[model samples]
Target: MLDATLKAQLKAYLVHVRQPVELVASLDDDAKSNDTWELLNEIAELHPDVSAVRADDDQRRPSFLIRRVGTEVGVRFAGIPLGHEFTSLVLALLQVGGHPPKLSEEVLTAIRELPGDYSFETYFSLTCQNCPDLVQALNTMSVINPRIRHISIEGGLFREEIEARQIMSVPAVYLNGEPFAQGRMDVEQILAKLDTGAEARAAEKIAAKEPFDVLVVGGGPAGAAAAIYAARKGIHTGVVTERFGGQVLDTMAIENFISVQHTEGPKLVAQLEAHVAEYGVDVMALQRAQALVPSRSPGGLHELYLASGATLKARTVILSTGARWRSLGVPGEDAYRNKGVTYCPHCDGPLFKGKRVAVIGGGNSGVEAAIDLAGIVAHVTLLEFGDQLRADAVLQRKLRSLPNVTVLLNAQTTEVEGDGNKVTGLTYKDRTTGVVHSMGLEGVFVQIGLIPNTDWLRDTVALSTCGEIEVDQHGRTSVAGIFAAGDATTTPFKQIVIAMGEGSKASLAAFDHLIRLPAAGEAVAA
Candidate 1:
């Protein structure tokens, strides 16, 4: 169960319990059930306000329900909720024990005001970094509204259910016994899906916002840094993004962040968000920018349109809309997405444990994914369309040393093979021989490089051949009163640290531009 240090930590956390909480188990006599009991027993013994009892009502063995003493505010775990889900379990206990959920007033009110029953079942893997947030959101909602119920099921522990439901990805969610969602999500995203008018309401709210001095159009490291720096300069700052973290949320290990020895993407994003919040930066999350309209006159407001038809105005705009994982456009790739084809190896690799899989591409990401998957899966076949690996020498050396990994250079993925359900294998072509081949496997991880999210700006901004926003050393774009940074720009490197530095530089440059401009509605030159 829990070690000494873990038990001590659990005890300290249990002190926040204000009401009697029960850990009702619906377990069998299996080894996993015994382990669950040990965990539950250790937790129950820590505080007087907590207790464990048997209730063999659920069909899922080794399951347990966390409920308040006198109310139906409860959540369930269908398996051992350790690893990434450990935080979800702790938060569930605190919330069910009468502690308020750590969400905004608007989100809390929305969850409590939901109209109908919502039995959310989130299928998760222990190693997935993206599953915890989604699971925790549902769990918190269940506690906030008794009509909502969330059951977090570990995909690794329940092989039958994973197969029966054809779940090939972690954090796969089901609402009221039907497919609901997949991938990383927060409370706001959940609400947007459940409430039909949530989008309209959010659009209206965003449209009512006043113009800002510096309005950043992303929420990755670059956008966060730009927003913080602008706000610190005593200028009105705002960040409008599709999501707060961007591709960073899908990332796992982040070892090269300078001062920080080691950290994960989600953890770093959380800290970045907190830092931005401290500066009182107006953050408009879950909003996608559709177009950018530059001001016709000096010091006039610049308009940024959203996909929801909501528009925001600002003095200067910083485009840091980062990049997304590039997918193999081969046939069946889209049809079997999350059904055996996945982009994130760190998040979905565990689902293919002990099974054969293929890693596409010859770049650093592809090689790294192959290396990481070698330790988890039975065998890994690395396919590269180039003649040689483009990863660093050190990475290539480590990848070559893996016994379970097979590297195939000059191989191009042609198509993904599936049985109208899950991915079965893939077809590839040999670059030199002009011969086609196929391999039977359970999963396919596409590690192709990222594509910058600058499609909407292609018509507005000066774009490079690859569609990256073209910018100078000072982060100034071709358009007046506009700047760009991060992966979306023509930056030499696509690292997080570089993006942040570029963002800060862009903010300073924007500030300089603002100070030299003429009064609003006055005639001036760029």
Candidate 2:
């Protein structure tokens, strides 16, 4: 049930309902069902267009359906969608009740014309920062087309089902009873995966696009800032990204972003997206850049190839592709990934409730993950390759204060041990004594560091030994008219504010490169 303050906020949001909405809940004698019944009643009273009733639409108990009055447009919930999913609930109510979803017209049409029947079952955690995107996206698709139905499940409340399915990650999605995806996914990304010819069609469309004056690849804070700055200069600007938010979407708490005291990653990404949209910057989402072919001449045109078989030409290019979580190449690590190995403690931590777990790394992320998981899991074993932890003194102190935490130094993770279905333990080597040991645990959280997303640009640009794009102080890369920024580049600290500043600097450097170039088909100025 919602409290007085939450009820007031829900009342304000309910005013957007232009059509009738109904809440049909399937219940039992359980406490969750009781809470669901009360929550549905409270929501129905918030607006005249909303109503609540009892029904067995689906056999799942303590679940509900938000259906439009006269149409099959709505979504189903396998458990009470609250906490991180509360936003999904609110957006579903509004979209199904005639409030339009914030999707491009092209995507909206694609969802409407989808041919096959799709029944999506998304398993999510209430604390996951990346789960809402898929939850809200599929819910909106169900509204767009009658053939598509989405049922989102809260993984914490359905432990038996999770174990049976061997699901170890948040936002694990299944399409028609088969594993579809296991990470953050937006509507466009989902459509690209579901529709077979969608990629080819998109490729052709992108190939036909006019060459941009300034083109940016990646959609993190750096890419967003670069696109905005370039667009402000009255030049043709475009940004292509596999997803708009990047790794920032996976981040849970962001309190040190300067100016603003506190904000979630999703909220910040939403604002960044909105800000980019305000400027007329052409946004090409759900596209991956496969290779970079720099133009031989300055300010001529740079060719960027996409994995979708599309090619984009730009006068200037800013590579802002961000980094991803570093993987432990140890055997069984890959096989056990999403089976018990994960990177995010905030999202998937609850799934390992009262279970023994290990955090590999000695840095801030590892210590923080250990501290956070110590509360939920039965015990925490932190294995560090170095002799001492590299985390801040404050964080190390806090991690040591936890009674359930155990720290091991000079320990090298050798292999992840699993039992075909799920992980059962780990193997590590003691560097000092050259002895091997094993620890029985249910989960492995890798927080060593980040690996830059720069494999696609390997031979095209000069890169550091660590694979980060080599860039000058002004953000100019080795290739003329080509610039780089953010985590993918040779930038230090790898913070959000630094990435934004670097992006602006790259845009300015790109603009300077552009103005000095001679007109098309003309020689250089004397």
Instruction: Per model, state how many residue pairs clash.
Output: 0, 0
Q: 1-526 in candidate 1: lDDT tens per residue?
A: 8899888988899899999999999989899999999999899999999999999584589899998998887899999999878989999999899888778898889988999888889999988999999999999888888899889998888988998998889899999999999999999999999998999999999999999999999999999999999999999999999989888888888999999989998899999999999999999998999999999877888999999989999999999999998888889999999999998888888788899999998898999999999999999999999999999999999999999999999998999999999999999999999999989999999999999999998779899999899999999999999999999999998999999999999999999999998775676554
Query: Model 2: which ten-residue window has the lowest total lDDT?
Result: 55-64
> Which regions of candidate 1 deviate over 4 angstroms?
520-526
Error of model 2, residue 200, in angstroms: 0.4
Local distance difference test, candidate 2: 0.92
Each candidate: what lDDT?
A: 0.92, 0.92
Q: Pairing residues by index, what is the TM-score of model 2? A: 0.97
Per-residue lDDT over 306-394 for candidate 2, one digit per residue giving the tens place of the 0 to 100 score: 98899999999999999999998999999998899999999999999999999999999999999999999999999999999999999
Clashing pairs in 1: none
